[model samples]
Target chain A: MKVVDIYRAIADSTRRTILDELCEQNDQTLFEICARLTNNHGLGLSRQAVSQHLETLESAGLVKSRKEGRFKFHQIDSTPLDEITARWPADASRSSPDASRTTKRASTETEEQS
Target chain B: MKINWTSIFVTDQQKALDFYTDKLGFVLKHDIDMGGPRWLTVVSSEEPDGVEIVLEPNSHPAVVPFTEALVADGIPMNQFAVDDVEAEYERLSSLGVTFTQEPTTMGPITTAVLDDTVGNLIQLVHQDEGAQG
Candidate 1:
């Protein structure tokens, strides 16, 4: 899952709700997913809207789907997500106090060049 | 209006399940498996139709980003309407839940901040009956 793609998948409140419902169950059919989302997640989004969001998530590779006869189960794709996070670029959000590591590293390179 | 489904993002679904169902007295509505992971949702024991609070795993990149940013910036998520903020704060504290910030009264609203065992900051607000006046 690309970081930007995953970020967009979670940007919407309704999509976030759907993701939570799917994660709670780990897997759910399209109908069950929609029902759980409507009943348990208060998505209030139309069935069509829910399907659209599911499509977006599926397209982003954040979720996996399988067709079982007439049903489709949705769940988190841990492998893709793990790989994406593993390759995350350092930002100020990290635990370390020194977030200027990037600047520091650049200065060291410049010194070596000079 | 009856709410049948609801979802909540959490760092650990199990702890959240225990907190809502056990401590808050919400009854377990459905616990089923989608496949590798199981679905667990609870309803208010008193008002099942009011709202569904879904217990969701914290895996979404945006959720992670928003929660971390909020924490770094110091803001609480949705504040839960409680009968008594201090009592809820104390009861929750005994359950091993940490209150990062104690109940502080700002005029009419008395609120306490609690760490919901995850990145989320849950708030208990005491609706000052007189706050409106």
Candidate 2:
């Protein structure tokens, strides 16, 4: 499967909700996802609409669908989402951008001295 | 008027009869010969005189596509009430039945979807007490 932009995949509110539902329960059928969207989240989306959302998530490697026997089940793969935080990690103590810039400069200077 | 019977389209009548009676424990209520496709129906063993489920043949051109789409999405064509869904899930699983969805609670109801093996999904549901709507 070709991986697409994770940000684009998660941009839609419905797609994010799909991920949320899968997080609560790992493996879910398309029907179960639709039911929860309507009942729990009050989003009455058509099955085709949900299918398209799933396709988008699949392209981003955020979801994986497995064909087991006659039915197909979907499971979330949040590993691809790890790239987002890896690109810009969260720091608890850093209050300003200058502090992070100084830390990066110090690390670069140490690398140069070595 | 009371609903005496509800129908589910099955790929084969004999296979549906076997699954419904032998596997699901529904007692055979009627087996009248209606020409090519027999008027086959079955009732729950617990309620022999209750509503009968008609296992109609999916010979219609439109029925196959309709059922196929539903099955593809893990949608159950019909639902049956059970006292305990998890217990039934165990019982049915032991009987070589294929379940697409396990018992999951949503508010007051717990439901599990399983393949009927006749081109339709059947849901076994258990509702919590005092939560009737």
DockQ value of candidate 2? 0.66
TM-score of 2: 0.86
**Candidate 2: which pairs clash?**
none
Q: Model 1: residues >4 Å from true position, as ranges?
A: A1-114, B1-5
- Candidate 2 per-residue lDDT, tens place, B1-133, comes to 9999999999999999999998899999999997789999999999989999999999889998888878878999789999999999999999999988888887788899989899999999888888887
CAPRI quality of model 1: incorrect
Give the per-residue lDDT of model 1 (tens digit) for A25-114: 665545445555555655556656776787888877877887433224577774556655655545534646564776766776798799
Which DockQ values do the candidates obtain, in the order shown? 0.01, 0.66
Residue-level lDDT tens digits of model 2 in A1-114: 566799999999999999999999977999999988887788999999999999999999999999777678899999998988765567623556677778886786798799
Q: Pick the candidate with the highest lDDT.
A: 2
